[model samples]
Target: MYRWPFISVVLIIAILLVLAFVLNLSIGEVWLNPFQLFFSENLQSAILISEFRLPRAIAAVLVGSALSLSGLMMQTLFRNPIAGPYVLGISSGSVLGVSLVILGGSIFSAEFLSSNSAIIIAALVGGLAMMFILLMVLKIIKDIMTLLIVGMMFGAFATSVSSILQYFSPGFQVKAFVLWTFGSLSKVDYPQIYWMISFIVLALFFVVLSLKGLNLLTLGTSQLEQFGIKTKRLHFIILLATALLTSSVTAFCGPIGFIGVIVPHISKKILKTSNHWRLMPVSMMIGAFIMLVSEMLTHLPGSGMVLPINSVTAFIGIPFILWILFKPLKNEI
Candidate 1:
């Protein structure tokens, strides 16, 4: 049997990514030719491509790659196959923060929560706060399963608080919050997309720098210490990078889930290696492709009906998670 080279596999994924991107740009309520989207004279077509679909498609790429990278880091950090931002409540923390901004009007300043910047800050603070709490818990509890339960509890608490806030919030505010919870890529426009790109790129840079350290981490902290690597600093960098990527996507894309958990596993299975050098880029491309496909599906093409992005992801994620749960755990990492 013959196998394709790594470079060949990457090139194939790149071509698929390009195709997915063009299809995402073209498929919607009213399909438009990808070529005409660029040079067409129609004002409506220009607006749809430039102002709406383009941003959403780009956002899909960013959200997918960011969440997948974050998930990979988390799985590496914890050495758990199922650990992800959504499963661990980091997204819920972000949701709590955004909820405060959108629904906690009586507690927060009405003027402040109106800006996109404010929402981003609120999400970062909330996500980091949750992460800090989890780390502290990890000190007392070495068992990953217990920590996972704790994370779920934290998510539940955050959701409960958000629910209470919604109870008292104005009808319009409640509606807005509910809509955001549905998780739509369409909510992200040009300005928000720019912020997402900047944050994800920053996180990607840090991940690239720390790839070697992360690989060593898989052997254990003591192994890193054997080589004179600063374990604390490396761990901090990975945690911070994951937080930034996870929070930025949640802040803009409304807590899109499962991309983080599923993408890493898929990448590892395809590449048949634990090496981050190959794992990272492949996971990112696969993630972006999955997200673009999900977005296209959510649009329902000719039916003119739209599905929530989260729903589409959940359909894919739930079964995979069940499979993971039932599979025997191995020392793969």
Candidate 2:
């Protein structure tokens, strides 16, 4: 096995993360100097930092780390490089949930379900429903590839249902659904961020416990079984953990993409290691850095206009994905 410069890589990533964090905090609609954030006497700047930018920045870090780790687990479990956190249809499930609330509420005149909190709840329920279905399927089918296919089918089914809802929805309702699909970190307030972070942290605990199993799984099922690992049970635990992490982020952030799909590969490329212990934390940090960069780009700095976070992520993700597809040693990455 090749040796990786783990310490050096970690230090570099930490520096990047710190820089991204400062830039994310400082450059917004109303730019504030980095020093002003801590010591400025202006009350409005303090409010903006605490009330608005802080929550969004925290959300970016939490959501990015959660999705990236989830993606790494899915890739390990399925032994598929293209497999992502949303590959299990949890995000589509979230979309379906949001669609029902946003579109359905419009049609039914149900004002209660139209609120931000209600929509987040609906998204969580929808995602968990699909996760439950996947768990049931996992019990019936032991083959990993087949389960991956089934998950895709479920995602397609959820998407179709959401499209039907959109078709029946009025213009304003359709617009609302469209905007939600675009993804936003700003919508998450401090209270929502607290719960989101809590769930992600809990899910991460399960992931940490399974780190040894994840390393074995990377060597293939036979190797895993040779170690007396119950692949099915391990798979269940990882899937559940992935579901919890991915679904919570999707519920609150509205299915932000590319972090899960791209960040793990980036970590592998930089760290030059397949070991989960190194890969997991590096991926989390890289994910956070990328998300902070994405958030900064969305602000457009001097333009006073913000781009959709989803668009920014896609722009960054798509190129890396293409590189992976076209690389001579694609499978190795």
On lDDT, the candidate that comes out on top is: 2
Q: For residues 60-83, could you state the per-residue lDDT of candidate 2 as single tens digits?
A: 999889999999999888877888
Best by TM-score: 2
Across residues 198-294, which tens digit of lDDT does each residue of candidate 1 receive?
9888888889878988888677443476787876566667766887788788888788888899999988877777789999999999999999999
TM-score for candidate 2, please give it.
Answer: 0.96
What lDDT is obtained when candidate 1 is compared to the true structure?
A: 0.83
lDDT of 2 at 34: 82
TM-score of structure candidate 1:
0.87
The runs of at least 3 residues in candidate 1 whose Cα sits more than 4 Å from the true structure, single-residue gaps closed, are 1-3, 106-121, 128-153, 170-172, 220-223, 327-333
TM-score of each: 0.87, 0.96
lDDT of candidate 2 at residue 259, scale 0 to 100: 88
Error of 2 at 64 (Å): 0.9
